[model samples]
Target: MSAPDVVFVTGNANKLKEVKMILASESSKINLINEPLDLEEIQDVDLQSIALAKCKQASKLLGPGRPVFVEDTALCFDSFNGLPGAYIKWFVKSMGLAGIVQMLSGFENKGAEAITTLTYTDGEGHFHTFQGVTHGTIVTSRGPTDFGWDSIFQPDESHGQTYAEMDKAAKNAISHRGRAFAEFKAFIATEFK
Candidate 1:
């Protein structure tokens, strides 16, 4: 039997690389393909809803019978009551990493959660969602500042290291995306095979 092909709708190279790495670590048999689409994302505080919408749009564009998936990630701060749950992208864009740290400077509770919602569509309107969350705290930038919010957000499991500070393998081992993909890989094993 040949590996199943699944389309991953994303334009971000970092995301693609990380997903590929995670999947490869599991020795996934799925032939993941990157289909970058400029789908208009709906404005919603719910990560699943946003991801589902993107998956639906991608399915429509890819047409019938093609398996496709889309992902949406969020960084929700405990002190802010998840104010930036589904708007982390915009927040990072406007505030920058330093600004984000500054925004939390007044708050002693820097606790936050990094969330990843992976929505998959079978191109027939059937959608399934997998979510993974990693709890952490907001700190001063400590690593590579290239990726969004990676330098300031440190996972709870990490020994005081930011995502950008950890190696690819180390980061993927406990990342929100990794956890979400773990669920996704299981789904593919059962559903596709």
Candidate 2:
């Protein structure tokens, strides 16, 4: 097998797929093991800490000798003073994208930001951290191709299109995950390759 020092641990399949795709070209020399790590989710006020917690859990589950990576993203709307930053997932499920749009319809300001924090741990227990942020605005209307909250959230100066409106390749090129994983890939290249 290729260099067996890389493992991506996540339970979100869609997120995992996108991440693997992003890393594929850069990680050809390494064995990219994809596995869902079982970890209990706890209440936290920040994305960095949550990602680290997940990474730690995965490393421990992997028996102290396997490297694992984890990522968590939070959507912060300036209009809401980042009300749903760390609680994005919960809010999305409870309020849905449409509800969020409706809730923000009256506000003149639609500014927002998406933040992703990534945490990685080598089998030796050494850790690495990275973060990426994309600033945007909340659109009053949903887009046709957008999934999740992408339909209702528009990036700043994005030439007028929601993330869901962009093609996968285009979205990947400028997404929060993409930005963060770019740093992550670089880290792996420098450290593992």
Candidate 3:
């Protein structure tokens, strides 16, 4: 038997890269294919709802009985009451990394949570949602500035290095995306097999 093909609906190259790395590490049998769709996401504070909506839309577009998945990531600050939960992308776009960190400068609490939600539709009207969260702090940007919010958020698990500073293996081991994919990979193992 060949590996099953699963459509991953995302446009962000960094996300795609990370997911691929995570999957490859465990020698996952699922074949992940990227379908970059400009699907409209529901504006909501709930990360699962946002990801589920996107996944459903992708399933419809791709036709019936086709397995597809969508991912939504959030960086929620403790002081902001998660002001930028599902809206982190927009905040990053409008404010940049420095501006986002500045928003927390006045507050004594620099605590934040990095979350990733992966919603999958088996195209059988059944949906599976997996979430992973990492407790961390928002600090001055360090390491490479290429990926989204990687340089600024330091995972508590890491000694002091940010996501960008860690190598691919190290980062994936502790990253929210990595944690989420761990659940996803297990699901694929049983469901797809």
Candidate 4:
């Protein structure tokens, strides 16, 4: 059987890489295509709402009978009660790795969570969102801080390595985005296949 096509809307090449990798296992059943769309990413605290909005916007562009998928991720700091929860992108841009460490320097409890919400639809006007969160601590910089707060976030399931430290497969094994996409893969295998 030929692979069914699905449009994945995202400008970030890294995201496309990860999503493609995740869907690779199911590639025989699903053919994923990248479509870069600069949709208005709402800064609302509700992750689901933000994901749903983006999914709807992207799906609208694709019109009817076309499947579209979109994802939104956030880094939530317990020290700040998830402040800048859904705004991690801007926060990371403004505050570098050093700034993040300094901000949590005084706090004894450095609890944090990495949340990823994946919203997808078959252009049936029924958008569905799947979320995954990794519970970890806000530790001092351990590895390269090249990507977002990866250096500072040490997932409890990832041994002692931060997201930035682990390679693509290793990180995806225990990442918020990976977990969410795992669910997405299962969904696609069943629904679109």
| Number of the top-ranking candidate, with TM-score as the measure | 3
What's model 1's lDDT at 116? 96
Return the clash pairs for model 1, or none. Answer: none
Candidate 2, after superposition: displacement of residue 52 in Å? 1.0
Residue 149 lDDT in model 2? 72
Model 4: per-residue Cα lDDT over 1-193, one tens digit each: 6877899999988789888887788888877889998899876899999999999999888788888989999888888999768887877789877787778888887889899999999887878789989999887788776667788889998878888888889999889999999898888778965
Residue pairs clashing in model 3 are none
Two-way TM-score contest, 1 vs 2, winner: 1
Clashes of each: 0, 1, 0, 0
For 43-136, candidate 1 gives per-residue lDDT tens digits of 9988888998899889988989899999999999999999788898998999898888899888989999999999998766789999999999
Each model's TM-score?
A: 0.96, 0.91, 0.97, 0.94
Query: Candidate 1, which segments miss by more than 4 Å at Cα?
Result: 25-28
CA lDDT of every candidate: 0.90, 0.79, 0.91, 0.86
Q: What stretches of model 4 exceed 4 Å from their correct place? A: none
Better of 2 and 3 by lDDT: 3
lDDT of 2 by residue, 1-193 (tens): 5676578887777787788788887766667777886787667877778888888888888887787888888888788888688787777789877787777777787788988899988779789899988889887555663245778777774677888787767777888888998898888788766
Q: Order the candidates by lDDT, highest first — what do you get?
A: 3, 1, 4, 2
Q: Sort the predicted structures by TM-score, highest score first.
A: 3, 1, 4, 2
Q: Model 1's lDDT to the true fold?
A: 0.90
Q: Following a full C-alpha superposition, what root-mean-square deviation does model 3 have from the true structure?
A: 1.1
